[model samples]
Target: MLIGDVARRSGVSARMLRHYESLGLVRPTGRSEAGYREYSSEDIRRIFHIESLRSLGLSLREVGLALDDPGFTPSGLVDDLIRQTRERIAAETELLTRLRRIDAAEPAGWEDVLRTVALLQALGSESAGKRQRAALSSAEEGPVPVEALAEAALSETDPNVAGALRWALARSGDTGLPLLAEGLGSPVAEVRRRAVQSIAEIPGGAATALLRQALTNSDVVVRRSAALALGTRGVANAVPTLIDMIVEGANDVDAADALSALASDPASTDQIATGLVGRLARGDVEASARRRLTQALADIPGTTTSRALADLSNDDDRAVALTATYLLTLRGAQ
Candidate 1:
């Protein structure tokens, strides 16, 4: 076949064929009588081989090595190609994410677009200070997309930066709740904990609903955080988890205060007092937990709580009995 025929049949343009020849990647096995380049069947096959290697992301130089170097092994080269492909894909994905966040910001002009881009870059910066400043400036600079704030809040590791991200999300209201809800399902325990913590700071019935869902999350930290937030919101469902926190001594003081806050509601007072007393009555109640439970009862006012406290005043554990007696005295004086 002549150069034109080879270019037509193989789809490798004549110019590319010449370039391949210059790189020593392919050479015609014959020359026409008229002096034009002519390719034999074997030359056509070699052209196909070069195109195939190039399809696998091999550079012309690598393709030359692959075809000419007897010692050239494809294993290392193939692995390297795979690594490079992955890096390219990661860069593309990051770029796409940035574009999406910028689009979601609905920038009014090039200035808004530039500010949003700068904030996003800072959010991902290696310096914690930059990240925190970005989080703080997000709302001030005209509201970085809520999605960006939610993503930052989920991944932020630095305590101060994380706090700022949470504050930004809270100010954004429940707009970020769905992203945070997805974060609650993350396999990483820390991510789940952060998701619940961020959601807790958002005030709304929607945030409350998400917190209620988080109460049943498989992660204990997530569940604990959700319970504390729910308690502050005056949701009665947190009562059980609050009681559990008291028993296990996990944030027991905060849990107790939450219980006390819940008790301020006339309807929940008896229920709160009863839950605490039931834990105290359990056969497995330890001395410390029982005392914490007794101390927890100090603020609960009701016949149920008073009767329980009076019964606890004569308990066998001296500390428990003293705590109960002290609480009862305070109650009587009231």
Candidate 2:
């Protein structure tokens, strides 16, 4: 068949077919008398194999090497792909676990999250040598029993379950936000806080709005959680509300947390730097708030904070002097 016919059949473009040929990944069996490339049924089969391998996250180079292997088996390739997918899923779950811990305030809950994280680390270490043994053992046993193991794993009340759920929601933020947003209005403060925390980890406009709405929760903890979540999104629109909460709010810890979140976001770092510098110049802000705000600004990268810190170097206030020194340390300027 012609290149166009192969493209139509395989859903791959002719340009990609030529590129694959140039890479030695595919070749035409022969050329017609008219000088057009001719493909065989075997060629189409190889193309489909390449596409499937690519979908499994294998690089073209790796796929080519695997295809060239005399001992390569279909089952072996499927097992490898499944293993790779599981590893990626595990890594994402671990990251989400850490994020949830950071967002959690209660010592007991945070410790539980930490323990799960440690277990995941240990599992990775222990599994490295066992995977090949397990694969070999599975071949002798006739089937891997993956479905049974997955069912058993899912039925357990593991602390890592929350991490896995949070990870899934983060990856599927578009689909998860509605459920999370609804949870924010739940009667339980803990549920509302978790919802806020999960939404904060997801970056999107709807998540931002959900967090903003959460700021109105009657419970102080819920309100603080929402403020922290909004800070993660770092939209300019949330700045005024966060600043108001910090400036007038009685909860010093929550205010400081919100400021830290705002400062960590690169988008809000410049504004945070300017606000902190203005407060320092006026000498009206509380000492603790000023200290936290200055440190937060210095922690974020960019030229804006550097220049702002340079201007503060001459300030007589002890907190300003300390923050300036910290900023200078970041620049390796002593």
lDDT of 2 by residue, 1-334 (tens): 9999999999999999999999999998978899999999999999999998898888898788777778766676678778989999999986775555334312246554454344333333334333323322322332222222222122223335434435444554355576566667778766666666667767777777877777777766666666666665555445554555555544545555566676667767777666655655555777665665565555545677787777666656687777787777867753
- Superposed by TM-score, candidate 2 places the C-alpha of residue 211 at a distance from the truth, in angstroms, of 2.3
Worst 10 residues of 2 by lDDT: 143-152
Query: What are the per-residue Cα lDDT tens digits for candidate 1 across 103-135?
Result: 988899999999998898898889999999989
- Give stretches of model 2 more than 4 Å off: 1-159, 171-173, 202-204, 230-234, 240-270, 281-284, 299-311, 326-334
Q: Please give the CA lDDT of all the candidate structures.
A: 0.92, 0.62
Task: Report the lDDT of model 1 for residue 307.
Answer: 92
